[model samples]
Target: MGIWRIGADVLVCSRFTVSPLAQTMAALTALHKGRADPGRQAWLREHLPAYRDRLAGDRVEELLVWAALRPRWLADFMITPPRDDDRTFHDELRRVSETPAEVAAADLATAIGAPLPPELRVPDLPGRAAALLEWIWTHTVLPEWPRLRRVFEADIVSRTGRLSTGGWAAALDGMRPGLRWLGDGRLQINTYDNPPRDIPANARLSFIPVTTAHGWVTWDLPDRYAVIYPCTGLLADAPTSPAPPVAVSALIGPARADILTRLSEPRSTTQLVALTGQSLGSVGGHLKILLAAHLIHRRRSGRSVLYYRSPLGDRLLKPE
Candidate 1:
C-alpha cells in the first residue's frame, strides 16, 4: 500500500485549483533562490502584478526557504511503478525531470532502489501539480502557517472560478468545513465577484497577497499576534550544520579528542555506545556537546539515528 492517500474530493480540487498555485509558488521560490526561470518570470510579469513586489528582498528569502524544502516528500510515494512491460520508464526519466513531482519520485526511487507504481493512468496523474499543494501544506503551512492558512483558504474560494473543471468544486466541498466556500459557491450566481450580501466575511474570506500558479491570491491572516504552531519537531529528522571545535570547557573535557575522532564517520547513539563501550547515556552526552560545538550533525533514517562530523570539525582536526 502507498504510504498516503488523498481523498477523491481533495484530489479533484487539488487537480484543478490548489495544485496550480502550489506550482507557481514553488517556481517563484526557485526564482528567489536565484534559480529564476525566465519563462516563469515573464509569465508572472504578464499575469500576476503581485510578483513585482513580493520578489523584492526578504520576501524572496522566506519564499525560497519555504518553497525549496517540500513537495519531494509527497513525490516519494504518489505513484506505483508502470507494469514491467510498460515502456514508460525511459519517458518517465526524461520527461519528468523538469517537473517537481516526477523529479521528487525519481530522487526517492534512487535513494531506495525501488520503483514507484503509477496510481492512475500516465496521462492523468497530474503528479507534479498534486505534489505542489501537499508539499506546501506539509512543509510551508504546517510549520509557519497558522496565519497564512486562513488567507490561503479564503483566497482560494475567491479564485475558484479560474478553474474550468468541477474538480475544484468537489475538493472544496470536502475541505475542512472551516474552508468550504469553493465548493458551496458552485450553486450560487456570480459567487466570488457578486456574492449574496448576507455572505459573512468568514464565508467570503480571502488569502493575503500570496501568488501561486493560478495567479495572485489575497488572503492574509486577520491578526498579527496569534500564537503559531510550534515547528521544532517537524524538522527533527533534518540534517544540521557542523559543530565547531573551539574547546568549550564546560563539557566532555579531553574526551573531546576521541569524540571528534569517532564522529569522522557518522554513527548513531547506539552505534557509538557500542563502538566506545560507553553507556548509551554517556555517548548521548558527548553527542550533545559535539552538536553544540557545531562539530557534528544528525539525520534520522527510519528508526535509527546517524551522526556525521561537520566540515568545520574536519578542518579543526586536520594537520596544519
Candidate 2:
C-alpha cells in the first residue's frame, strides 16, 4: 500500500479546499473510461455523447486524453496543487496552459511509460491539453459546478467535524477505498505497490472532494499537496428510491419517514446531516422522535453515536 509519513505539524496545517479544475479533470477521466459509479451515471450519460461527437475526428485530442489518463497514472500537469487564493477555474487552468512544453511531454511520457506516440509528438502540448480541458469544463462541468461545489462543501463539513471530535482516524477512513490511518503517523493513501513517502515538513495538505467516481493525489513538492477523493453527488434520490410506504410516510410524516428509510445501515448524526442536507438541529430532532417511538436504535461508537433502523422500523419500511 502507498503510505505517507505525515508529521503532526503537517496534520495540524491540513485544510479542506475545492477545485473546479480537479472536478473537471476527474469527470474527463470517467469519460475516458466510458463508465461511472452509480452516483455519477446520470452525469456521464448527459455529457459523454457530446464529448464523443467533439472528439470523433480529432486524432491528437483523442490520443492525448488516453495517454494523460493511463491506468494508475496521470500527466503531472493535469493535477495542479490547489491554492487557497486561486479561486477561479481559469487561475488553475493557466498552470496547465503555461507549462513548459518539454515538461508536459515528459509528464505524458511518464504517465504512459513509453516513447511518445507520433501523434502526441507535436507542438504546444500544454495549450492543447488546456484547450481540451477548457472545452470539457465549459460544456460539461461548469454548468453544474454550483451543485458540485455544494457536495464538496458538505463533505468537507462532515469531515472537519470528525477531525475535531474523533481525530484524524475518523476523518481519513473511507475517504477512498484503500485509504486508512494506520497507528502513529502513517497514513495509507492507496493499496498500490509503491514506496512510502514523507510529505514535506512545511507542506500545506489539502483534501479535495470531487463528484466523480475516481480521484488521485498530487503535489508541488515541499509547498502544496492535494488528495482528491470521491464524495458522490448529493443524495438527491434518498427520498425517491426505496420510497417509504404511503402508510409509513403517513404515520411518521414524509420527512421523518425518509430519514427512517435511510437508516437500514447505521449512520451518525453528522453523516446524516451531510447526506440529507439538513441542519444538525433538524436531523437531531427527527432522530429523537424516531428513538422515542422505538423505530430506530442508537449505538455509541468511539466519539460518535450511530443510528440504525430498528426491527419494527424495518417492518414498516418493508415493501407492501
Candidate 3:
C-alpha cells in the first residue's frame, strides 16, 4: 500500500479545502474519458460532443492529456496543491501554462511511465494543454460551478463534523476504496505496492472533493500533499432531492417515502448516514422496514450492501 507516515503536526494542520483547479481537473478528466455519474448524464451529454470536436484537430494536445492523467498519477506541472486561500481558476491555471517546457515534458513522461512522443516534446505542450483545460472549465465546468459548490460545501461540513465526533480514522477512511487510517500517525493513501513515504514534518495536507469519480495524487513535496477524491458519500449515497410525492409520503410516512425515493439510485447504510444525517441504527431500521415491505432490494457492491427500489416501491411511487 502507499502508506503516508504523517506527523502529528501535519495531521493537526491538515485541512479540507475546495479547489477550482482541482475541480476543473476532475471535470476535464471526465470529459476526456466521456464519463459522468447517472445524475450528471445530462451534463455529459451536453458537453461531450463539443469536447470531442475540440480534440479532433489537436493530436498533440490530445496525446498530452491522455498521457498526463493516468490512474493514480497526474503530471507534475499540474500538481500544484491549492493554498488555503486559493485564487480564481484562471490564476491557478496560469501556473500550469507557465511550467517550463522541459519540466512539463519530463512530468508527462513520469506520469506516462515512458518516453514521450516526438510531437509531445515541443515547447508548446504546456500552452496547448493549459488551453484545453481552460476550454473544459469555460465550456463544461463553469456553468455548473454554483450547484457543484453547494455539494462540495456540504461534503466539507460533513467531513469536519466527522473529525470532531469520531477523530481522524473515522473521517478519513472510505474516502477512496482503499484509503484508511491505520492509527499511530499512519495513513494509507492507496493499495498500490509502493513503499511507505514519510511526510515531512509540518507539511500541509489537503483533502479535496469533487463531483467526478476521477482521482489522482498531487503534491509540491516537502510542504504539501493532496488527495483528490470523489464525493461519493453525498453524490451517490444520500441525495437531497428526489423528494417523494405527497401521496407517496402520506402512504409510507414522509421519512420512509423519502428514503424509498432515493433508492432509485442504489445506496448503502453508511452513505445513508452521511446523506441523511441519520444515526446508523435509525438508517438500518428504516432499511429493514423497506426490506420487509418489499419496497427495496439489495445487492453487494464491494464491501457494502447497496439497496435499490424494488418494482413494488416503484409502483408505490407511481400508483395508477
Report lDDT per candidate.
0.38, 0.82, 0.79
For candidate 1, lDDT tens digit of each residue in 1-320?
Answer: 11112233433333211222333344445443443232234433443343334435434233323333343222322222212233422332333333455454454455444564443213323443344334433443344344333333333432343334454443233222122333343322111343333222322221222322222222112311010111111112223324434453223465555666667666655444434445545666878988898988899764345888899777766635
For residues 126-186, what per-residue lDDT tens digits would candidate 3 score against the true structure?
Answer: 8988898888889888986765665666567667767887899768756777788999999
How displaced is residue 224 in candidate 2, in Å?
A: 1.8
What lDDT is reached at residue 291 by model 1? 89
Q: Write the candidate numbers in order of decreasing lDDT.
A: 2, 3, 1
Best by TM-score: 2
List TM-score per model, in order. 0.23, 0.79, 0.75
Q: Model 1 — which ten-residue stretch has the worst lDDT?
A: 223-232
lDDT of 2: 0.82
Better of 1 and 3 by TM-score: 3
lDDT of 2 by residue, 84-105 (tens): 7897999999999998888999
Best by lDDT: 2
Give the distance in Å from residue 25's predicted Cα in candidate 1 to where it truly belongs. 60
Backbone clash count, each prediction separately:
24, 0, 0
Candidate 1 backbone overlaps, count: 24
